[model samples]
Target: MISRIAETGHAVGTAVGYRNLSKKGQRTVKAGLLLSPVLLWLVLYKYLALGYNVYLSFSEMSYTGEFSFVGLANWQQLANDPVFFQSLFNTVVLFATIPVSIAIALGIAILLNQQFPGNNAFRSLFFLPYITMMVAIAVIWQYMFKTDGGVINYFLLQLGVIESNISWFGDSTWALVAIFAIQVWKTVGFYIVILLAGLQTIPEQVYQVAKIDGATRLQRFLYLTLPLLKSTIGVCMLVGIVISFRLFDLILVLTNGGPGNGTEILLTWIYKQAFLHGNFGYAAALSVVMIALAVVVALIGRNLQRSSHL
Candidate 1:
């Protein structure tokens, strides 16, 4: 009787273990089912598109959609192209706005962090440019910067800042300057919002303790606040780099890369090559180079952030 009872108990224990395993297997199937759509989308859209672009960089594609593999010819042409280098240089020049934007945004964010009247309203006002349609911004700024009857030129003439109306979009040098100004104006609000979020993450108690320890405002800001916010600043710089590199619509609408390709950037150049000139392979090579540069910069930024934390 004791032997029989032990066998039955063992069978019951085995069945229970099997049921637990079956339930776990079902849960795993459910999880996989939930994730399958996202995985499929990435596979179809992101990875496949990226792979096709890479392949296209090595192959020549005619305006008639005929594809012929011509390895290294497009890349060789890109290396010898002066316009490519010019566009690259123009793109690099826009990077200057990143530091300026960061500095202005940091100051504004700090000021807004302090308790004051209408602080939220001010933030919303500043952020308006970021959300505003780029086409509208381009149209408005293009009109404002006009040499004749333009609001900016009109004001400058009235204030005796210039002897005559400046050719903002007409002159190459001044056109780049105008683009820089617009870029900074449009991006500063975004940086301010990001920095404000980072600032809030810092504890009030820490600031109070620093005060008790006789830390001056500047000292606390430099040593405590900056160090704590290093990660956030790194993130902003990375984002700024990407934004500066991807600049296309504003340049396209505002200047159309006119006055002699002065405001032309990598993207605009690529667009012209692919659509206007029908040099799709060369354009693909240019795109690949741009992607590589972006990846390298992002890696460097990540390393710097990691080092700062260390």
Candidate 2:
């Protein structure tokens, strides 16, 4: 009996040792595996692209394939460049419309949150514009806003409103207004969808409690909805601000910063500087400034989100 027991114990110990070695060997193999596509993407798409752009910003590389070391030339030119300053001013004007658009989006979100017929249909209708091609939207808007033969002007003309049609892209002041209006139209619906998601995440139980406590609609919105929606709304604002700053395709299709450059934005100006004028170094510097602005905007948005939560 003692001999049989000793033989069984030895067999069990051997099995345990084999199992331990197998696990370690498997782990070692896992650790030394070849690069996955995700790792390759991180190296090629992210790091390499970022490093190259940063390097290009400091060097003068014109279309002629010539390179020269120009330190601070582009950034220095950015300060004195009249059009760059104009573009910056245009960017500020563009951002001014964000609050108004967000306000409209909030109202839409609130309406969509209620239990009503065709609510999904209404939501889809609002969201459709966001997914539509920007080029198509820009073309259609420009036609609608045309100084003559435009549906908008035609309605006003039929009503005997004024002797002259408004030249939306003709004058500097009106040009910016036209761009701002288009931007708001394109962006508000997207933001509405975002706010709608945030609104729906809110608990029905909370609203029921608010009602039992004799809280008004406005009170609930102020005390509960708005406070709880800080994060979602902050993200939407960041997206809107970034889109406004980086607005390119729409500008390219619509006005092209034309009518004497009245509608020029920073990105449009950068395009002109880089491709049209072939000032690569200056354009790179402008690109750096834009990146810096983007960073600042992101930081400010995050800080505001934190403060709102507090």
What TM-score would each prediction reach against the true structure? Answer: 0.85, 0.80
Candidate 1 residue-wise lDDT, 213-277, digit = tens = 99999999998888887877878889988677535889998989978887888889999999999
Task: List per-prediction Cα lDDT, in the order shown.
Answer: 0.87, 0.80
lDDT of 2 by residue, 1-310 (tens): 9999999999999778657777777676556565466778899997887676677777789678788887777677778888888887887678776767888899999989888999999988888877788889888988998898988788878899867898877787877887778788778888998898888888889989999999999999999989988888778778877667535888778788876787788788888988998887777777776777766767766765786652
Single out the weakest 10-residue window by summed lDDT for candidate 1.
301-310
lDDT of 2 at 73: 73
Q: Positional deviation of 169 in candidate 2, in angstroms?
A: 0.9
Q: What TM-score quantifies how close candidate 1 is to the native fold?
A: 0.85
For model 2, the superposed segments whose C-alpha errors exceed 4 Å read 1-44, 156-163, 304-310
* Candidate 2 CA-lDDT value: 0.80
What lDDT score goes with residue 42 in model 1?
Answer: 98
C-alpha RMSD of each candidate structure in angstroms? 6.7, 8.0
Checking candidate 2 for backbone clashes, the offending pairs are none
Per-residue lDDT for 160 in model 2? 97
Best by TM-score: 1
Highest lDDT: give the candidate number.
1
